[model samples]
Target chain A: MLGRLNHVAIAVRDAEKAAKIYGAAFGAEISAPLPLPEHGVITVFAILPNTKIEFIQPLGETSPIAKFVERNADGGIHHVCYEVPDIVATRDILIAEGARVLGDGEPKIGAHGKPVLFFHPKDFSGALVEIEQS
Target chain B: MLGRLNHVAIAVRDAEKAAKIYGAAFGAEISAPLPLPEHGVITVFAILPNTKIEFIQPLGETSPIAKFVERNADGGIHHVCYEVPDIVATRDILIAEGARVLGDGEPKIGAHGKPVLFFHPKDFSGALVEIEQS
Candidate 1:
């Protein structure tokens, strides 16, 4: 299930440069750079008109985003985040539909102080889908 | 530069099923589906919280989104669309910064009836960025 799009995550090699490119190109204002310790990465949020584009860079070599960049050979579209009213119900529905839940445990505090869970790409075609309750 | 995120485009193998998956899960109302003969694909738009997530399936083999889904071996995040105040100025800035322009010729009417241009992934890392002026 999906709600409104909360944010579109983009994996960038250099968050600063990427932010600049986006800032100059689209006049997106950099809200703040946040450290997502649980995800092992630091991210910058550029607030655009109706949505926020997240610029994510891995803090460590073993970080999942870093590995993804390596696999894709560059930073690309990372994930599409949907704002759901209820995270638990959404997770249950997806799980029942044979979707692979990357986190069956809990919704951790994500970059924007929202509870977020990621669905594995294996279950949802080729895209990593994030469900956030706010 | 950006007015608002017009839509978040997700490449899916089956637009109908993806629409169902998202619809049943998030209670998203499926808007009228549209086909862009110029883009060579049929797409369904599901409007959610405050934004829209587009489920796109290519109509032919030569479509860019079609080729992308094939390269990734699965449907995934296709591109992020940013609404710009002036498409011409935005294009000039990216070009001045050595960004590779995928379509330098002209802005074609995209699926949503807006003039759109695509920026090559080579210039901006691994993501295809589209700019539309409403």
Candidate 2:
């Protein structure tokens, strides 16, 4: 089942400047930038008391974030991650309900170092959904 | 300062169908559809343990949701709402920090019957951020 929301990922061209807004405006603590070559994005976590805002910038031209930015020049909210007790079971449930899981239908290691899987945007009202192991 | 994330609003063509996925897949509780004609959107709240996912559908063509749907076709995550202790103070802080507050720079009575204001997406790394009075 879906647990608490882990974080909302926003795709941006400049993750640092974006993180600065949260840090300066809301006084949120910010994590040092982390690069995930496997995911092809650099992430900075803007920590709030309740949840985090993950700013993701494209690592390379081939990165998905780059493609997303090309389509949405201003960059925008990319995907939302929600915690799940058992990601495998959650994936099964979603599959059974006709939701198309992104990638190879297998959980991959996400930025949080947890097993996570993404659902197709079309099945989620055009909003990409990620379920991460809690 | 920004408090916890209150909810993420998704603009969808059909709020009921969008809410159904959370209900069926995650067994999440869903609120009855409520029409907010003033905002020109019909809304349904999908209750999660940590926060709510708000599904919004356009009540009329003039609605902002309708315009978003026109551009996106399938609809998508429209904006994210974060709770704040003092919206006026938050607005002042954002303005002082060079963030553009959307609309007339005054808090409006939002769907939750609390004062709320939106920050421009361009200023927020492409994600429209709403700060609502807690």
Candidate 3:
């Protein structure tokens, strides 16, 4: 079962710049931009009271979110991640319930260094969803 | 200053139906659909451990999210709501920092019966942001 609403990922052209207002106006703690070449993203986290807002920028030519950023142009909420006690069990239930998992239906190390799997947006009412092992 | 993230609003055609997966798969508590005619929306809340995922359906022809749903076709994140201690003060700070508040630059009673103000997506990395009074 789901544990907590882990984080919301936003795709932007500049992760650190996009998180500036959160720090300057909202007083949220903004983390330094960290580029993960494997994930093809540069992540900047805005630490909120209950959860985190992750600002992600495409890192390379083949970045997965590059197209999303180009299409949105102004950046947008890319996905919402939820924590699960057992991601494998959660994935099994989701698959049994007819939800399509992205990327070979296997869990991969996610941005948070935890096992994570993504569900197809079409299955989740048009919103991209990520489930991470807590 | 900002408080906890109030909720993430996902615009969908069917509020209750869209939240079914959260209840069935994630074991999240799903609330009965509440129609807010004044706000032109019908809402179903999926209660998570740390926050809520609000599924909103347009109630009327003039509903604000009607166009968004039509454009997305598959439902997508409409906006993210964050709580603030003093909305007025927060608004002033955001304005001073060159963030454009949506509409006539005034706070309105939100779906939760709290004062809420929306910011233009252009000012916030193309993602619509809502600030609600805590």
Q: In candidate 1, which residue pairs get closer than 3 Å at backbone N, Cα or C atoms, i.e. clash?
A: A1-B25, A1-B26, A4-B49
Native contacts matched by each model: 0.79, 0.79, 0.81
Residue-wise C-alpha lDDT for candidate 2, range A1-134, written one tens digit per residue: 77988999999887887799888989888988888888899999998777889999999667877988787777799999999999999999999999999889989888889999999999999999999999
Separate DockQ for every predicted complex: 0.69, 0.81, 0.86
RMSD of 2: 1.2
Estimate, for each residue in B25-104, the C-alpha lDDT of model 2 and write its tens digit.
Answer: 99899999999999899999998887889999999768877778888777799999999999998899899999999889
Model 1 residue B127 CA deviation in Å: 1.4
What does candidate 3 score on TM?
Answer: 0.98
Name the lDDT value of residue A57 in candidate 3. Answer: 100
DockQ comparison, 1 vs 3, better candidate: 3
Best candidate, TM-score: 3
User: Which residue segments of model 1 deviate by more than 4 Å?
Assistant: none
Q: Who is ahead in TM-score, 2 or 3?
A: 3
Off by over 4 Å in 2: none
The alpha-carbon deviation from the true structure for residue B116 of candidate 1, after best TM-score superposition, in angstroms, is: 1.1
What TM-score number comes out for model 1? 0.91
Which is the leading candidate under DockQ? 3
Q: Candidate 1 residues B59-78, lDDT tens each?
A: 77677677776776667878
